[model samples]
Target chain A: MLEVSREMLAKGTRAGLKTTWELAKVVVPTAMLVAVFKASGLLGSITDFFAPYMGLFGLSGEAAVVLFSGYLVNLYAAAGSIMALSLAPKEIAILAVMLTFAHSLLVELPISRKAGSPLGYVLIVRMGCSLGAGLLLGVILS
Target chain B: MTVLWEGFLQGLQGVWTVARVVIPLMIILEIAQGNGLLQKLNRLLARPFRAIGLGEEGAFPVVVAMVFGLTFGSGVILNHVREGKVSPEETKVIGTFMALAHALIEDTIIFMSLGAPLLLLILPRVMVAYLMAYLVNRRNQHLSLPEGHHIQGIN
Candidate 1:
C-alpha cells in the first residue's frame, strides 16, 4: 500500500512537471506579447473593431484575442491572453465555457479526423456548440 | 522594455497560478488511477453511460477524456478502435462527447483561477457534450458510418 502511494506520487509529480513545462513556454511568451500589444494600443484598436460582435457574447472586443489564440494555437495561449486582458468574472466564465468546447481546433480537428469521426461533422458540432453556448451564456448572464 | 518585463512577469504569474491548481489535481488523479479508482468509477458509470448510448467500450475513453482531456483521451480511443475493441461508430459517438468535455479537471481548474465559478465553467460543456452525443447516437443508425481511413483521407 505504501509502495503504491509512493509510485502514484512520483508519477503525478512527473506528469505535473511535464504540463508545467509545456504551459510555461506558451503562457509566458503569449502573455508578454499581449502586454506589448496592449501597451502599444494595438489591442485597443482591435478591441474597438470587434467589440460590437463580441458584445453579443457578453465580452469586450478584447476577448477575441483569447478566443482566436485558443482556437488557432492552444489553450495556454488563450489563458495568457485572458489574463492579459481585464474582464469581468462573468465574461471570463463565458469564454471559459466556449473554449472548453472548441479550443485547439487546429490540432484537435485533425486528431478527430484520424479517430474515425467525420472531420466536417465534428468541426461544425464543436464550433457550433461553442458559439451557441457563448451566446446563450451571454444573454443569460446579462 | 518595461512592457516586456511586465508581460513576462505577468505571464510567469499566470503559469504559477495554474501550476498550483494543476499540480495537486494531477497528483490526485495519479493516485486515483493507481488505486483502481478510475476503473471503479468506470464501473459505477456503466449504467449511466448506457443510458446515454455510449455502451461499455465508450465509458473508458469518456472517463479518460474527462480526466485527461481530449488529446490524451482521443489517443486512447483511437487505439481501442485500432484494436477492434471499439467500433468506428462508437469512436464517433465517444469523440463527440470528448470534444465537448474532455480535460474536465485541468481545464476547469485553470478557468477557476480566473474566477470562473466551478459550476458555470463545468456544466455548459458537460451538458452540451451530453446532448450532442445523445443526438449523434440516435441519428447515427440512419447515417452511413464513415470509414476511419477515408475520414482521415478527407484531410
Candidate 2:
C-alpha cells in the first residue's frame, strides 16, 4: 500500500507540474497584455465603452477584460486579467459566476459538436446561461 | 518600458497564485483516480443523474466532466457517444450541463483565490446547469413522444 501511494504521489506531482506550466503560459501572457493595455491608456477607453453594458451585470467596464478573454481564450487568461484589476468582492463574484457558466467558447463549442450537440445550441445555451446568471446575481447581490 | 515590466510582474503573481492551488489539486485528483475512487464516485453519481433525465450510461462522462472539466473529460465523453452508450438526446443534455458546470473544483478554487465568494460561485452555476438540463431533457422527451401518446404521458 505504501509503495502504491508513493507512486501515486510521484505521478500526481508530475501532472500538477504539467498543469501549472500550461496555466503559466496563458496567465503570464494575458496578464502582461492587460498591463500593456492599461499603460497605453487604451484600457480606459475600452472600459468606458463597455461600462454601460457591463453595468447590467453590476460590474464596472474593467470587467470586460475578464469576460472577453474568458470567452475567446480560456479561463486561465481570465484569471490572469482578474489578478491585474481591482474589483470589488461583489463584482468578482458576479464575474466568477458568469464566466463559470460560459468561457473558452472557441475551444469547447467544437467539442460539444463532436459529442453530438449542435454548435449553435451549445453556443446559445452557454452564452445565455452566462448572461442570465450575471443578471440574476447582479440583482440579488446588489 | 516600466509598464511592460510591471505587467510581467503582475503576470508572475497571477501564475503563482494559480499554481499554489492547481498543483496541490492535481496531486489530490491524481491520487483519487489512481485509487479507483473516481469509479466509486461515478457509481454514487449515477442515481442523481436520473433527476436530470440521464441513465447509467450517461452518468460516467457527466461525472468525469463535472470534476475534471470538459476538455479533460472529452475523451471519455466522446468515446461513450461513439460507442452508442449514450443517445443523441442524452448527449445534448450532457453537453448543456457540462458546458455550464464542468471543472467545478478547479474553476471555483481559482476564482475563490481571487476573493470571489465560494458558495455564490458554485451553487448558482450548479442550479442553472440543472435547470437547463432538465428543460432540454423535457424538450427532447416531448419531441420523441410516440404518435399515439399524449404530452401528459411524459413523466
Candidate 1's residue-wise lDDT over A1-142, tens digit each?
5235777888898899889989999999999999999999999999999999999999989999999999888889989998888988788889988888888888888877776777898889989988998899889989
Residue A76 C-alpha lDDT in model 1: 91
Residue B89 local lDDT, model 2: 83
lDDT (CA) per prediction? 0.86, 0.85
Off by over 4 Å in 2: A1-4, B147-155
Query: Candidate 2: global Cα-lDDT?
Result: 0.85
TM-score of 1: 0.92
Q: Once model 2 is optimally superposed onto the true structure by TM-score, how far is the C-alpha of residue B10 displaced, in angstroms?
A: 0.8
Model 1: per-residue lDDT, tens digit, B1-155? 99999999999999999998788878888888877888888999899788667777778999998988777788888788888888766777898888788888888887888888899778878888888888887777656555555788898
Off by over 4 Å in 1: A1-4, B143-155
- Which residue pairs show backbone clashes in model 2? none
Q: What are the RMSDs of all candidates, in order? A: 5.2, 3.0
Q: Over the stretch A1-142, how does candidate 2's per-residue lDDT look in tens digits?
A: 4124777878878987898899889988898899889888999999999999999999999999999999989888998999888888898888988999888889999987776678898898889989988888788878
TM-score of chain A of 1: 0.94
